[model samples]
Target: MTPLIQRILLATDGSAYAARAEGYALFLASTWGAGLDVLSVLEFPPGMNPAYPINDVYLGQLRKEADRHLGRLADRASQIGLSVRKQVEIGIPSEKIIAVAREHGDDLVVVGTHGRTGLEHVLLGSTAERVIRGAPCPVLAVRGIKAEAVESAAASVPLAVRRMLVPIDFSDCSLDALEYAVQVAKQLDAAVTILYIMEPVAYGLDFTLSHPSELEAKRARLGDRLRDLTAAVTGCGLQADEVLRGGLPADSILDYAHSQAVDLIVMGTHGRRGISHLVNGSVTEAVLRRADCPVLTVRSPKFAPDHRRVIRKPEPAASSG
Candidate 1:
């Protein structure tokens, strides 16, 4: 499993979405004992030329304004009893936010998306999507109102993360995600369900050949992986369960999560491959598109490796020449 989140970066722009991101970040900080770093970028006003030198008076005034904006976040965070550090940056919004995340060695980046649609999204891609594609660590996209308000308004909430769903393909990246999920579950006194999808079964295979026993064997293998994952956090004290489904990976994951009312989904994006890498793949892209719950995606390096896993690059089946 991946390491617990110790440092988190919240990219804010004074938008309601940014505030929402801040709220989620604060909640996570409280849950994991993580440090919150809030950032806001300073952009030149419209029609202003970067090459032109501006008056010192205007520069001072602008910096003061930016400071006030960021100060509000700190104040709110403090009031909520969440420890926070904030900064005001001057550069492109997405770039500056990414650079700050890189500098801080943050394990998670939380950002709110305004849910842009149609031509607007086509013309100006989402900052949240950009960061997700480029970030070195996991990114949580919080939607709707800031989750803090939701949590506060609903006190006596008995369901404090009881079930976590993690979709794995026996890959190192997926194992890393599983580890991360286990750590979170431990903190919340929750249980986890490790899910694996048998892709070929999606096509309705019914073969009683020499490999008739392979299906059961594969199920047993998945069971072993689940055991090993939970073993790492057994002492930390969290119940772990396993589920194996046969069908499309994304569909299976989504159906299971909804059916089980999973609190969260911890997944790993293996840095996309080939030309398709230019865009998010079908499975991940699909999950992110319609998932009602929060989705945590881990990139490379921070992801843990599974010792019992072996990934042999698929060999193209021979053509009937």
Candidate 2:
């Protein structure tokens, strides 16, 4: 199977961000020769229960509006030469989107975030954030869109995305992310820049005075590992580079990307559990918050084989004979 997204679900709430997502979705669909499925979730009207006293007319009107929204998105996607499909569902937006994506075998889910931070995200509780946490596949969150003005602002992004920036920590997850990034860069006929951040904690005051020498040794070792890391990709006719930087992991990553004006940031989420993930938020989240460009997050897989060497016993009698 093609690892790149072949079936994409673009969820819209008639928001401006949704519209921008649709435009990006179209571009991705065309570039990857994928199918586009646009979905709009109809929220339950305030304090209205489906089980309560009926009003067919009102419900029908709501459904009609939902249909109208989905239809417009479908038409627009079609105009962009994408094979499009759409559906409107009523209930919680994130739940319905997750359901539809799973039911339709969507490889990627595209949703819009309002770019809420601090108190705003807390007050409103972002649906995009919920979906990202709960999604079965990779989720692309595009913030900064209002629901009402989607159609009017569909403009082309003139920049051609050619370089992909990938941050690696040499963990299994980071390695997997690097692999995915290399594959994507190869597909786009672009180059890959692998960034390794030397965390601040790795160099505390308590550390030895010869820490600089130790760091240099470690850098050389990491360079060798990076060489091995890029071997397969380079062999497959892709260009790759390795960069080492020191500082906060996420900040360093974002800074490097901005300095290089990279088009995309591809990183992996270890998808850590509970307190660990909460205490040490994923770099994916940090990049999502700070990046001026697009970010693609690949979730790491978790299957390993057991390979223990078994020592054989010699026949003592035979040896003596």
Q: Each model's TM-score, in the order given?
A: 0.72, 0.78
- Per-residue CA lDDT of model 2 for 28-94, tens digit only, reads 7877788988887766655677656565566667778768877877776678688988787877888
Off by over 4 Å in 2: 1-3, 45-48, 51-62, 115-125, 145-153, 156-159, 201-210, 271-280, 300-321
Candidate 1 local lDDT, residue 115: 27
lDDT of candidates 1 onward, in order = 0.67, 0.69
Full-model lDDT, candidate 1: 0.67
Q: Which residue ranges in model 1 land beyond 4 Å of their true spot? A: 1-3, 42-48, 51-69, 115-125, 145-160, 202-213, 231-236, 271-282, 301-321
lDDT of 1 by residue, 1-321 (tens): 444677889877665435545666777877877888988777545466545556445656767876887888788678767788888876666677788889999888987654222221221256666777788778886554443555563354432457778887766677666766766676777888877887654223564343658778977877776666656555456677677778767778899889889877778776223333455454665576556667777664353453232222235679996
| Ten-residue region with minimum lDDT total, candidate 2 | 303-312
User: Model 2, 173: alpha-carbon shift in Å?
Assistant: 1.8
lDDT of 1 at 190: 80
Query: Which clashing pairs does model 1 show?
Result: 1-179
Q: In candidate 1, what residue range of length 10 has the lowest lDDT sum?
A: 115-124
